[model samples]
Target: MADSFSQAARAATNELRQLFEPTPLQRNDHLSAQYGAEIWLKREDLTPVRSYKLRGAFTAMAAVLAQRSDQKVFVCASAGNHAQGVAFACRHFGVTGVIFMPVTTPEQKIAKTRIFGGDNIEIRLVGDYFDDTLAASQGYCAEAGGHFLAPFDDADVILGQASVGVEILDQLGKEPDIVILPVGGGGLSAGLTRLFRETGAASSFRYVEPFGGASLTAALAHGAPETLESVDSFVDGAAVARIGALPFETLKNVAMEHVILSKEDSLCATMIDMLNVEGIVLEPAGALAINALEQIKDQVKGKTVICVTSGGNFDFERLPEVKERAQRFLGRKKYFILRLPQRPGALRDFLGLLGPHDDIARFEYLKKSARNFGSVLIGIETTSPDAFEALFSRLDNAGFVYRDITNDDTVAQFII
Candidate 1:
């Protein structure tokens, strides 16, 4: 069964060459040295759509058109990468497509989708949330009798995604020691795992998902796909609330210990590291696999590892926020709410307490809680994480009262 599936996946991949050539699989010395392993990156980020999503979208659309030449319309709902994939496929096939996206999606993404689809697709700005957008798209597809292209759950889509595994084997010329995959709804991970297993590959696998969106972890624990109570949208590309039903069918046997949940803030640091040290720009979801490496560094030592750099559709507009999150995670930056005496030279005294390497990024006087004291919110950035210890010591010695609010999500959201 696995052999037959691998053959089908290979055929699908051969067909995909008409759309775009295989994305590069390159060895990375930077990560290799950092982790004491031979690290190779399957650069899906280099795809025409800057993601592996294009492979699945194109494969599913082509399979439908091949079986039913009369099928002239397709529909899908996506806020980012998938939308672009479908749009690109629609244009290539000369089929009419309707894509529904959340109203809050960035304009940059919307424009890119429009460009990819050209006149072959129509864009619908729907509800503020993804679930609402997906419902609207499905309803419209049913009414119009157009084929709805699922982003990951469909069999054809999964088969399309299996091509990634095929390429990894072909490009590397051998099975790797371990394959680290970043999981969203599990199309990519499931497809690759199935293909590799069927082909008799000896490669082990590690799955990575955002800590705030550990749908796979939840599903494995519940013995089925389970919807998360809440999801953090920070890693927009991989922040899925539930794993796809079809994908989970293939991945259900995966051991819990093999799955690694990456903190969203730590992922930001990975993104920054990749950008600064390796000159690779990765969105939060794209950085998931690389981020998981730190957690398993001991195991990967002296081993041949493949980390799929999933996507590179990062918006430069989010760079500042990414840097701030990265700094906080690295302990080189912090936020504090200070109660200071509302007397002359008090501000100067507080400023004197800061070390030479410390810089105030933000300072705001909230309000006077008492006649003699005022509440102040301050954000400090320092050259080293250790600088905070000395700065805090000085505050203690000066009789200052302060509350660290850097990790206080509720307080930081409102004020920071």
Candidate 2:
């Protein structure tokens, strides 16, 4: 079954060539040297939709339409890349599509998705959250007798996503020693793994997922799909609460040790690194596989490896937040709640403890607690991480009682 699916994927790849040439398989010198490995990035970010989702959407829609000629209307719920993929595919096939997105999805993303679909698709902003939107889409599909598309769970979608593996092997002329895949809904990983196994490719595999949404690893541990209680939406593309059933079936035998978890903040650091150092603009989800490589650097040394850069639907408006998260994760920034005396020279005295490298990024007085003291929220950024040690020492010596709120999730989330 896997071999037949992979063969169909290969044929789909050939058909896709007519729509868009294969995305680049380029050697990344910076990443390669940093990891001591010959790291090649399968630049799925270079795709027409700037993601591998398009392949799956196109393949599934085409296959479905071929068998069921009367099924022209397609419905899907996605606020990000998947919506764009379906939209683009609808335009390609001259079919009508209805996309349901959470009302809170970024305007930039909705605009891009609309542009891709043009007149072939309709964008509907439904519920404020993804779950609500998905339920609404499914309900609409059932009521209208329209075909509903599951982003990653359907076999045809997986077969479509397998085309990425086919292109990678063809472009490389052989399989690499390792293939790193980013896990979201698990369509891409399932598709690629099936492709590798069916083709008799000997490449080892590593799966990376956001720490807040380690659905794949959790599913692997439980031997079935398990929905997370909560998931951080920072890495929006990969923030799935539950792994799809079909995807889990393909990836069930994967060793738990091979699944890597990357922190959302740390992923921000990699995003900044790739953008500033390599001139590569990647979304948070796109950086997961590359960021995980840091943890296994020693193991991959002198080996040829491929990292799948999942998507590039990043918005520049989030750049400041990304930089802040990166700096905080690297310990170059700190947020604190300080109680200072309410005196004329109190502010000056508190400022004296800060080193020359420390810059005040944010300041807010929480409340005037007593006649002599006030609770203040302060955010400080520094040139080097060592600057924090000296600053903290000075604050201690000055007899100021302060709480580091950087990692305090409750306080940070509510106040920061």
lDDT of each: 0.95, 0.93
The candidate scoring highest on lDDT is 1
Writing each residue's lDDT as its tens digit, candidate 2 over 300-345 gives 9999999999999899999999999999999999999999999999
Model 2: which residue pairs collide? none
Return model 2's CA RMSD, one decimal: 1.5
Give the per-residue Cα lDDT of candidate 2 at 324.
92
Which pairs, if any, clash in model 1? Answer: none
Task: Using TM-score, give the best candidate's number.
Answer: 1
lDDT of 1 by residue, 26-130 (tens): 999999999999999999898888999999999999989999999999999999999999999999999999999999999999999999999999999999999
